[model samples]
Target: MLDARLKEQLRQHLDKISQPVELVATLDAGQKSRDLHALLQEIAELSERVTLRTDGDEARTPSFAIRRPGEETGVIFAGIPLGHEFTSLVLALLQVGGHPPRVSDAQAQRIRALDEDLHFETYYSLSCQNCPDVVQALNLMAVLNPRVRHVAIDGALFQEEVSAREVMSVPAVFLNGEPFDQGRMTLDQILARVDSASTARETERLNAMSAFDVLVVGGGPAGAAAAIYAARKGVRTGLAAERLGGQVLDTQGIENLISVSHTLGPKLAADLEAHVRQYDVDLMDLQRAVALVPAQDASGLHEVRFESGACLRSKSVILATGARWREMGVPGEREYRGHGVAYCPHCDGPLFKGKRVAVIGGGNSGVEAAIDLAGMAAQVTLVEFMNELRADAVLQEKLRALPNVQVIRHAQTTRVEGDGSRVTGLTYKDRDTDAVHTLSLDGIFVQIGLVPNTEWLQGGAVELSGRGEIVTNAHGMTTVPGVFAAGDVTTVPYKQIVIAMGEGARAALGAFDHLIRR
Candidate 1:
């Protein structure tokens, strides 16, 4: 359930709700936990218009139905609400209770414009911070358009359905029972899947051009910076990205971006895209580099092929393909992604404010996440697999300075412990004692390592790290002369945004330098 402070906050928010809302949970009384009943009972007491009723069969044992004030039709939640999904529960109630719609006019316009009968089934874990955003967007769309039906399924609760769909991640959406999206996505992106016209336009654009002076792959901070710099030099620059904003889109708090004191993921992503668009960058949107054929033409331009069947020839290619978080791959870890199991603390840490959380790894990134989480979380536990902390002396000192943080070295994470809905705790083993220990908490932050996105370079001579990261020299030149690299995808030690941007600038200059020399 919620702490008193949070309970009060919910109560306050509920006070403003003008309509009645009912959450009918289909659960067996004998199998239900006492804490759950108590929690719902307390929530029911907070507002006169809010009520929780248990009237379900065996099959629907944890399903939730959100009934509006007077509407006969209600949205369904085929999962329990806990962990990061607690926010989703509150959001569902607020939306169904006829609280003034929080959607923007453009969002409403897009919802209204939906021509197809879209049924969005979002498979989510309780701890997934991104899942709620996707669910809330879909929920809003459902409220707007009768044709649009949105249902949130707990991947943990309905394992059979998840396995049937092969849902590997949270925030996974299925459009008309087909796999749609697998991760956190913008609203425009979700619409693009259902909108045929939008897809056709993208197809046309990709088929139109097949050549560029400088081609930048990946669209993270590094890729965006490279594209902008290359285009400013008045060269025919092109940018191909799976999505406009790279990993920065998943990151939440971004205070270290120099002048910007504070910013969120979505805002930074939009800004990066806008900045890139301001330049003459070709901006091949939503295209991914699948294959690279080196020394293709006599002109020395390499032929780069995309998954979308669009081929582009580039005299030089800057590989700015970023890195993805290294998952622990433990039981319940994959099931609880976006739920309690989180990789980017910057993106999902805020969702666990005042909640008990654990940070895996004792490296700089782990310590940094612990320090960051300590600012808001009630308790921060730092678990390091190694005997000693690998973070810098300064960061270790900073982490030790926080009274709310406790460091546990020589601890190997065993499994993430969670109820059917959300994470309640985690189990780890003491490397010295070989004894397992469980710590009750709300969230788990994994800051182990970053795996670079360089799998597509299978047939190329691009020198890469043993870990598959692209290896490059000071001039951002890869093993190949015309081919360059930068960002997290490269073997750069620091994966910070500022560092990536700087590397991007250097790579663009290096490409220009190569052109002048040639």
Candidate 2:
């Protein structure tokens, strides 16, 4: 039934197909004509392939099978693969073609032996540029191992899926149908979690009873400083963190920190960790602090339990848990984050150097980031929800002096717009004038504010301020004796690295005083 000319063209296209290459095409049941059938036969005669069969009569049933050319895998969809679903089909073919991107051999072995089928539902918005690395890393792993299957649902495209999963943010990944990890995770960490889950039968939960003299809860600049100061005081200090660096690791540079004129957050955290390690501090990486309770026997000692069920008793505690960036909480804001939007100027600014950028927020952090980025980026637009900037006069003067920095006060971000891959610009509405404007930029830095990391200590003995910061006396003494707090977690007027380090030293001294007196 096919025309001779069309059949010859199909034969030629099929003849050109080579080994180690797989072709996947999506065909609709209603659109399958005689010409298309002849083309399919030509493809079958030329190479091995798999065809996905969809019932033209029955709308619900869609099945896949290996056709004559079983080597080439063709994906036929009952529905269109347009929008977000197209990428999934391409990734599947890439996996079947033996072009599994980049998984280590050891990780691959562990992944292949995984007995249970894994369903990874990654809820993401194309707008979230920061999440692609996480998605790409997981997809690469899935490709390497057949047992792993990653299904990425565009949170914005599929409203039902988003509400079902309670997807609050982009880059949120779920493993084995359960919410496993949030934010972002590297490839190595993903592999570790998979291996842990796969070999979970052989592992037993470790019991608590391991104790230390001083326990540091976080591993950021403040936490690392506390560990170093405490260890130097000759106390058996222990430091625990889910990641080596706290939020600071996301920063690109630190110009305000005394002694360090310029330093990347990750590098600074690494060096500080090295210094802490040199002093005999017991460092536990990839551990989450779950709870803090008073020790049973000791009056001043407190027990710290980790998510891993490992616990440690400490005579004193320094709550150096830092802050996290507050999101705009707008629709599609999470999806576009990291793609064209970011939270850390120091970390992602350099990547957009000489390009246009928008800094959202009017406080010190926002003004500071705008000023800093103006030096690197071609043009910097500062959007503030408040009427005026809360930054100090000196910083205000400095920001005003920069010709490239444009401050738009009393403006709120409405939505972020991007090409489903990265950010192109953003939309803002003027609160006073009710005027809306869209500005084109390479990146948008959300410097709105920071939320203190003190939720874990709630109902504990430690006193917290109205703003949720832990309360400490001038000497870093908490309301509870023998318990001390420091860094951003405490009610410190200024949140600076040097100030936190000073407070850490003071807390360590105070702990020593308590121990000696006891």
Model 2 bad stretches (over 4 Å): 1-191, 197-209, 296-301, 330-332, 349-357, 367-380, 390-406, 414-429, 434-443
Model 1 whole-model lDDT (C-alpha atoms): 0.80
The residue-level lDDT of candidate 1 at 111 comes to 75
Cα lDDT of model 2 by residue, 184-296, tens digit: 56565676676776323212322433567888888787788778888887888888777777776566557988877897565576688778878988776666777888655
**How much does candidate 2 score in TM-score?**
0.59
Clashes found in each candidate (C-alpha, N, C closer than 3 A) = 6, 21
At residue 487, candidate 1 shows an lDDT of: 94
* For every candidate, C-alpha RMSD to the true structure in Å: 8.4, 12.3
Among the numbered candidates, top lDDT falls to: 1
Model 1 C-alpha lDDT per residue in residues 304-382, reported as the tens digit of each score: 7887777888889999989888888788888777567877665455556677999998887899899988987999999
Off by over 4 Å in 1: 1-114, 119-146, 149-182, 195-201, 329-332, 335-340, 346-357, 371-380, 391-406, 414-427, 435-443
- What lDDT does the true structure give each of the candidates? 0.80, 0.66
Residue 190 in candidate 1, Cα distance off native in Å: 1.2
